[model samples]
Target: MSEITPDLVRHLGVLARIQLSDEEVERLTGQLDAIVDNIAKVSEVATPEVAATSHPIPLSNVFRSDVPGDMLSLDEVLQNAPDAADGRFRVTAILGEEQ
Candidate 1:
């Protein structure tokens, strides 16, 4: 198990430019020790054959078959638009100049 000591905690606090009190350093040393020990335990159980995953359960993409369907005509599609150009939607200039 990784050893987390008061000296290490103080050194980390200095490296991080954090002013940790003596009491805080003592408390964090124990907490960090426990954390490292637990991580070590988990490492022992994780074997080469065991696939590492971010989530506990398996996941897959649920997608529908790509098939074209009937679509509304240009006029019908733009009927509800707030503003439209010759045959497309028109809005305020976003980039100061049109592309």
Candidate 2:
């Protein structure tokens, strides 16, 4: 009941521009057949009534609640900075880009 044949494997090798050895082609044919059989088994287990989903269980957000709190003054923020320019933090130019 193997769906993949050595001839099909050889054809695929040619299409992919690969020079597979005779043993490799035989091995790939068997492996591909097993993969196809497994897929068929999986499809059989899946029912139309069962909705497709990304996860097995329901997921909830693991982040803190977004509650707006405090606003820091520009001078307060610039006080601890190594350098400040035009009311903003000054950083070194990177990747040949102008600062």
Measured by TM-score, the strongest candidate is: 2
Structural similarity to truth (TM-score) of each candidate = 0.74, 0.76
The per-residue C-alpha lDDT of model 2 at residue 95 equals 58
TM-score (C-alpha, index-matched) for candidate 2: 0.76
Backbone clash count, each prediction separately: 0, 0
lDDT of 2 by residue, 33-99 (tens): 9999999998998999889999999999999989999989999999999999999999987756553
Stretch of 10 with least lDDT, candidate 1: 90-99
Model 2 steric clash pairs:
none
- Model 1 TM: 0.74
Question: Whole-model Cα lDDT per candidate?
Answer: 0.93, 0.93
Q: Any runs in candidate 1 off by more than 4 Å, and if so which?
A: 49-51, 94-99
Task: Specify the poorest-scoring 10-residue window by lDDT in model 2.
Answer: 90-99
Cα shift from native, residue 88, model 2 (Å): 2.6
